[model samples]
Target: MTPYGSFSFFLILAVLLAPTVILGLQGKRFHTYNMVVSIVALGIIFASSLTQAIALIIFTIWQVVLIKAYITYRKKSNANTIFYLAVILSILPLILSKLLPFLSVVNVIGFLGISYLTFKGTQLIIETRDGLIKKNLPLSRLLYFILFFPTISSGPIDRYRRFNKDFELEISGEQYKLLLYDGINKIFRGFLYKYIIGYSINHYFIANLRFIAHSHFEHHLYYMYAYSLYLFFDFAGYSAFAIGVSYIMGIKSPENFNKPFLSRNIKDFWNRWHMSLSFWFRDYVYMRFVFWMTKKKWIKNRNLLSNLGYILLFLLMGVWHGLEIQYIIYGVYHALLMIAYNSFERFNKKRKWWPQNKLTHVVAIIITFHVICFGFYIFSGQLFHKGV
Candidate 1:
């Protein structure tokens, strides 16, 4: 089980009803549910470790600061570089913690949901800064939006605007029942995916590196693909858990994946795989790069620079995975494959003899899957070790 399993979840369930539960007994309308929830959450966080407690405090302050700044900016009809800096400041810990682990003695930087919360919080601030959205949420709703226990771990990475839109509705009986059942189903499904599927494959099917060291290319290649599938199921299972839990809380998070294996090309696979991360990069990084490149007239051909931009973007994507040399190689490897494939497509667009049918699609999928699998070996750091 994950560290924040049953006890943490039931604690949240109790906290969710603290307002009504307390009022029904004592007959008062004090909005002290947040205090109750925060106290319980703080206790759990402290019991878990100091790292989580610090993270919780940081995120709680983050939500408050962003909400205040956004509201103030909206009222004044002005921009604040200070607010943008504050957003960056809030994100700095996630970056340092995730990246600096490669150099640390104690690899103890596991603060659950820090990555997801930072993404969601920064995007909220960005939209607010752009005047594309407003900040009118009440304290309770804003607290719920940011610190809702379900999606706080690994996330489907919902945008602030979509989440905020559904904030006001009362949690109904039917909704609660449906959500609870769905959450339970998701938990079971995630366990199956992680343990039954991933553990079995990792333990037995994939050959050890000692075997690979002496084996032929084909043997190593097959294990590589199996390892890749294990990664997908592991990550996808966690995403399912996050999204399913959100559903039970009466919120619909964006799906984090599609049937990524069915994709016909590298680009298509990225679209299907880690959908939330891909979109976040597109919205925050790629589009901004395109716009800036277009305006500066640095390159006469937009397509040329756009492709280069993608390679650079994926370099950052690689670093986001980790600060290891393997991760950098993984990033560069995919970028080159993507670039070459795109270039090939552009070149073949003029040739009538080039295969462009289902057989061709199947071949591309197989090849791309291999390419991704090779990259996963780099991600693993150690090949086929136990519980990798």
Candidate 2:
């Protein structure tokens, strides 16, 4: 059963969360209960495929061992080689998962949520290397954080420190009630977005458009918009469900979307769209790259460094989606847009040619929206399809 995909899954979730609700309302900590539920839920999620179950088990064990070992070593020394090795090992499974399929090899190591789980592991390793996680975390806490079933598949990628704070909090009954209300509201929104609107667009508009001659420009145009909307609603809806469930369990997983379509620029759109993932890339990948380059004096020109960072960031993001040609093109396409927009912004700042007003803001939003939709079109692989 897919997570958050069916009535049965929701029914089971309700049943499982009943104890959590009761405990929380009584102002009791439900960490142990939640952990148990997470394990059980994971078991159920991977039950249909024994291979995937084994893969998940092995993956979890690998991460646990690696984290513990790294933490132990980190206390004794701060070696750059060791830190890099730990980071590489943390992401190795995800790398293999993405690469093996392209090599026409059966992916024995890949499983659902491998990418997100790898992010969690890699984050822990990085923070440990940076001496942020000074205290030795317990095995149970580590397992619970890594295997938290709510945001397992896709994430608003919670940080270790933030998640631990929530896990250890002792909330009042009044606060619990508020959290419960918010959780239910977000779940309702999820249903409306994913089930009602997203489904309607995919089934009615996108499906019908596919039948009306793919070579037609109008058909492709209609599809681009329909697909862009569908992608947002579907993903945002899933994120809502994940975050809401996290709230009910007393962890406020971060928000992933914030009116992305209304963004006024490419950078602004990224800040508002799949925010957690984009922010993850920005924080972990782009920032690190820039800092390293600066420290090494590899690229002295700030603009040149920033442009290169954008290229690497988007390309890595694209490859993360898959090793498809369209995905790579989509990444390069966005990189160019970002560079162009940055240059234009710098030029306009000096000249003050573009007026700062409601009309300009609206026009920018409109232009940015189209730019994003075209990127989505590339991401959809529709342009690469044979008949198109």
Candidate 3:
């Protein structure tokens, strides 16, 4: 029943698109078809199990109510208590879901899309408080945005304002055709990434690595390289499928990855890899930290403030991955890398002797790729596995 992993899923998706195609071509506007298709798609996903369905329903409703209420009150006065309470209440379900599992507790609140859904809701709440999302949107639209099944599980997280524009658009025949072309192209590419190449790399290389480690096989370090590429293709494949599906439905969702392997440094890699999440953290967390410190006159050194911001950003990123030690280390590793890169750039800025040619860029990319592969090893959590 999950997306992008099964033939049955695509068959179901195609079948579900009947209503959308009909309503879309009738000049009934985007919302008419968009709402219908979104509901049918979400209904299909949520209908598989009662527990997840209930959890998702409860979570969505809770956030909507909280957000709407907060918006109303925020118009009168924006108190810290109200804002924090609303934000905490909004994330309570996801917190419980994430924490309960780590405690060896029965995961009552857990659902497949809970993390992404909660992130969307929390963004809505924070942006609303900041007066960015000013309108008290319709409940149906809000639900559609949160439970937008195309990206419900994992995301190239969409912004409320950006999505609203597409929701309001009525596509021309030319535009619709272009959307179709791009959608199908991305979907085919996703097939290559996830089903073909991704599968081959995983089942052939990574699977064998486990056996090799236990056996007398040598040169086992190749497993790390294989795992890293497999990861890129596998998750990038899923993201491509998700984004492609969104396009077919008329939402130009932001991209997740952008030639990440070609990046020249940790700073450049973050900008390219899992771009939506990175950008989200950058704008909301990292930038905010810098702004807060700058506002309070806490530190006058611009470079120091920026470096500290990177630490805060990556630490939050690590914690968000989970409260695991390896994840924390992964975050610290990137933070330190970014800081060191920043310092290097500052030191090199005064020197006319530093290379500024394609050769230097190529060398930087090579070095950056290895560094990222090592980070991926930590992220893989294999180092901490008891059997390993």
* Overall lDDT per candidate, in order of appearance: 0.69, 0.93, 0.84
Candidate 3 ranges with C-alpha deviation above 4 Å? 22-30, 210-220
Q: What is the lDDT of candidate 2?
A: 0.93
For 281-347, candidate 3 gives per-residue lDDT tens digits of: 9987898789889999999999999999999999978977887888999999999999999988888
Residue 285 error, candidate 1, Å: 0.9
List candidate 2 stretches off by more than 4 Å: 210-215
Worst 10 residues of 1 by lDDT: 22-31
Top candidate by lDDT: 2
How many collisions between residues are there in candidate 1?
A: 1
Provide the lowest-lDDT 10-residue window in model 3: 212-221
Candidate 1, position 157, lDDT:
79
The reply for model 1, stretches above 4 Å from the true place, is 1-46, 74-87, 99-110, 169-185, 207-219, 352-355, 383-388
Best by TM-score: 2
Per-candidate TM-scores read 0.80, 0.98, 0.94
